[model samples]
Target: MSALRSRKIKYFFILPSIIWVLAFTIFPLFYSLGLSFFKVRLGKPTHFVGLANFERIINDYKLVNSLKVTLLYVAITVTVQIVLGILLALLFHQETKGKSILRALMILPIFCTPVAVGYLGLTIFYEEGGPLNSFLMSLFGAKIPWLSHPTWAWVAVLLLDIWQWTPFCFLVILAGLQSLSEEIYDAAYIDSSSEWEIFRKIALPMIQPVVIIVLLLRLIESFKIFDVIFSLTGGGPGTATEVFSLYTYRTGLRFFDFGYASALSYLLLAIVMIIINLFFKRIRAVYE
Candidate 1:
């Protein structure tokens, strides 16, 4: 009875969060799942369509294009973030003059919103009026169509994502570096290890967990990227930068193809789950 009473007391504190999750997250997820089976249209009767929606998605050219674009964006952004973040973290890990101020400046991008970052990208990359073009005009006297061409539009979006998120990876990696014991470094020095040998043999091994975590976070965040691309490219002069999220938004809200959009969302969820599982397996193997 005493144990039961203690359990009840703990349950009382947990009830609010459970209720909140049920009301907001669980409910919406189930509702969307339900909607995926019906042919729902505005001001029209929803008919059960079974797997018709899923079948349509299999043949959707635009959806395929969006998927390709989304994967490319995710791959490029995550790779750049991990590489730059680790380099920055390693650079700032040592004690030096003005290091504190440099660390603060390095983290500034993490505090900025995605929308603000996108707008800032516009200011820097805008074809005729931006600083990049202005500088180019001063030198070689030409402008780059950064946001107009389909290829360049994707590149521009990737740049915005990298600028805003590299700092996030840097912060996480830096924390991981701080958590490591200094004894290892001292021992390596006593053994007359070169700097490169110490980094490869000791530093990399110690920070592997942090690198995995940083890569996973960046992968998930990049896969669902919408705000920066939306604000900067609006999916571009064409469907060039139309990512999976924007594709879902257009289908659900703009086109009122609720069933199809829900199906697409679930498909994306499945893909992400698979990717995460594979990543975990790969990282676990490395640890072993």
Candidate 2:
């Protein structure tokens, strides 16, 4: 009876969180799933459309372009963040003076809002009046079209992502680095293992799981990237930077095509799920 009472108390404590998840996350997700299947329009009854929305998505060129851009963005941003984060983590892990201060300073960017970062990027990269163009013209006497050019715009977006999220990746990797046993490194040092050898043979393997998780998180976040691009470029220069989220936003809110936008969102969700599944499968394979 005591055990039962304890379990019931535990359940009662957890009930709020479970209810919150159901109300916010699970319920909304199912609602979106239903939305994906229906022909939804503003101020009109939502009619069941079977797989019509899905079929429409298959034929939509804009959705296809958005998917491609989103996938590319995720691939590039996630790779860069992980690699740079690991490098920074390794550098900071060494014995140095003011290491704590450096770590605290590095974590500042992670705490910054994405919208603020986007605005900062704009301040730096905006044409005619931005710092970047001003510097270039003063130093080398050359004018660069950062916001005007498609390639430069994309590079700016990547730069913003790297600046904002690298800190997060650094924190995760640094935590992992800290958790690694010092005895292992001491033994490696006694064995006359080079720093490269130590990193490859000792550190890499120990941190692989954290790396995988960080990569997955970055990948997912990048796919949903909107605010940065929207604030920076508004997916302008002729759909050059229009990623999936931005595309769907334009479709639904700007164009008011709820059904098509819903279809695009569903397709985006499917792609995200597929990528997540692939990552898990790779992780499982490595573990096995």
* CA error at residue 89 for candidate 1, angstroms: 1.0
- Model 1 TM-score (2 dp): 0.91
Candidate 2 stretches greater than 4 Å from native = 1-6, 279-288
- Output the number of the lDDT-best candidate: 1
Model 1 misplacement above 4 A: 1-6, 43-45, 279-288
Which digits, one per residue and each the tens of the lDDT, describe model 1 over residues 1-288? Answer: 134455667878999999999999989989889889899888242799998999998899999999999998888889988899888888888987898788789789888888878888888998987898899899998878999989987888888888888988998999998898999889999998898899889988999988988888778878888888888999886999999999999999898889888999999999998988978877677666
What C-alpha lDDT does candidate 2 achieve relative to the native structure?
0.86
Task: Compute each candidate's TM-score over C-alphas.
Answer: 0.91, 0.89
- Give every collision pair in model 2: none
Given candidate 2, what's the lDDT at residue 206? 95
Question: Lowest-scoring 10 consecutive residues by lDDT in candidate 2?
Answer: 1-10
lDDT of 2 by residue, 1-288 (tens): 134454568877999999999999888777777777778777242788988988987688877787788888888988999999999999989898999899899889888888888888888997886898889999999877888898888888998899899989999999999999999899999999899999999999999989988988888788889999999998977788899999999887887767767677777788888888988876677665
Quickly count the clashes in candidate 1: 0
